[model samples]
Target: MSSSGIWQPANDFRRVVFWRHGRTLWNAEQRFQGQADIELDDVGRAQADKAAALLAAVGPARLVSSDLRRAKATAQALADLTGLDISTDPRLRETYAGSWQGLTFEQIADDYPTDLLRWERDDISVRAGGGETRIEVAERMRDGVLEALSGVESGETLIVATHGGAARVAIARLMGLPYEYWGTLSGLSNCNWSVLQETGNARNPGAEGSWKLTEHNAGTLPEPQTEPVED
Candidate 1:
């Protein structure tokens, strides 16, 4: 652990940052994107440019992104600064909200109230729009992240550009949180990111330790964790 009471990756360890894509028209309009393959709007491009500068300073070694245009675009910004090749993975795409794609929250509430409620409740079996459940998404996300991390060397940082919902679920799974408690973690805002430090070699199958969430929904660089003090 570092002096800030937060665990920092040692020379033998690695770090992973899950970055959410910037705002799209649907995102700005409060519509459910859910693997719709939307591109970043003008404002989103600006957001990515700013964020890429900061993230680039940290010296990320590799970039992996969802195959969707929005995520690919966001990763491209950081790649431009870092000069790292981007690897796109379809498994990192947002939850496929089958019939619910392209609808607003209000529309889903009115049309599929029960399913919406179940989704909000984090029901593992509840598949919004007859799409994959949270568990399914989590599994695929875990696999994709692990596959990407396999190439990451110690003391290196791997950045993942993905959608908000996909990032949250993957974070929860990577942290070993149960599916029902996934909602406890706040959602990521557009262009914000979460950081996870490896406690063990999660890249190796059946590794000893889990990935610990060091930061969440952050626009700035990570700060030290505040620990309790004794008088």
Candidate 2:
């Protein structure tokens, strides 16, 4: 114990389930929503309903969401099912696409080809439409996840409802990866979630504890394997 009588490196391990928002019209069109505040389409709402039913079965203790409309709507489904209040954080928002916000992939490729190329090359400093770089997105997202971790107790699950880009950056940052390696983790599909469990070690103590990826992009219930008898 420290002289201050506080637990070093925090008091407990935690579980974070990072949920990607359901589909939007732009998502179907392959347009980048970024921070555009697009709401969910009808199909998206249905996806959220089914996904929430499954997630609520696990009974997450806390719920935090990106302030964007699409994310909020998806989170709301879970909140409704679980009867848990929703907390919104702007830092959980997607990487801003800046000038590419409303443009299709082909449009951006034809017009802002240089920027798109840099982004595709994993240029951490490259901005899309003067929007945030991968590093900037990582830093802010790390802040939100860390803060969320600090607020929740050990063993309690924190359901973070955020965008695909933001969730990847946050998870990569928590996993202690350099910004360049963020691309190794695939973007989550709509209404899917990734799980990170805090597995702290008493042997080594730090303000931020270690996390493990127990699951990634899980959307459906698990299937039980049936054994063949009397072949």
Candidate 3:
């Protein structure tokens, strides 16, 4: 695992499990719920429960999540199953959608087509009214991931619950993918889980160790399920 400070991996450690929070009321409405703090829908709750079950099977050592309600709720479910404490960090929150919050894609396109188009083009500087720019979102998310990894020892596994946009940006930054292609990747399904591994020198890290995408869009659990929310 790469090290920027005193934290050194006991081994060539680098593995992270990225889980997208379950469906939300906004998600059901096909709206841009960035940083809006919406709760998960019933299906979303079920998704979180299923995610917890799957994660329990793998047994992660640590659990981290965005401070948003959706993400926190999802993390809690996993925490309950694995007996790991859930930690919240604002840096992991979803991309800020500014004035676009609660608006569906069709609405945004109808009202802010030019702005929407610019976003689609991956303009890092473009801001949707009160929303954050792509660059700003990327920086915060990078910091959050690094911070979360700092506390982990080499070979220790971590589970992070986050939003769709944030998850995409985080993975893009980690893999050194170009920002322009950020929107090209497949959208993470609600409650879907992805895995990444960290490796390399304690002082420096590279993506060369072993990074793989595990389960994606795994379905919901049965009744009385727990779920996650955005931070």
Give the C-alpha lDDT of model 2. Answer: 0.76
Task: List, residue by residue over 1-231, the lDDT tens digit for candidate 2.
Answer: 334221223335577889988888888787877899889999889889988987886657899998999999999999998899998999999988887887877788899889888886668889878989888887898788777766676657789999887787778877777667767777677888888777655122123336767777777623221210000
For every candidate, C-alpha RMSD to the true structure in Å: 6.6, 9.9, 6.9
| Each prediction's whole-model lDDT (CA) | 0.80, 0.76, 0.71
Which stretch of 10 consecutive residues in model 1 shows the poorest summed lDDT?
Answer: 222-231
Question: Least accurate stretch of 10 residues (summed lDDT) in model 2?
Answer: 222-231
Candidate 1, residues 1-231, lDDT tens digits: the string is 543333345556678899988878887777888888889999889889878887887778889999999999999999988899999999999999988888888888899999888888789899968988988988898899888988888888889998888888888888878767788887777787899887755555334247888888877434221210000
Residue 122, candidate 1: C-alpha displacement in angstroms: 0.8
- CA deviation > 4 Å runs, candidate 1: 1-11, 200-209, 220-231
How many clashes would you count in candidate 2?
Answer: 1
| Colliding pairs, model 2 | 99-129
Runs of candidate 3 with Cα error greater than 4 angstroms are 1-12, 199-203, 206-231
Q: Rank all candidate structures by their lDDT, best first, as comma-separated numbers.
A: 1, 2, 3
- For each candidate in turn, the TM-score is 0.88, 0.85, 0.83
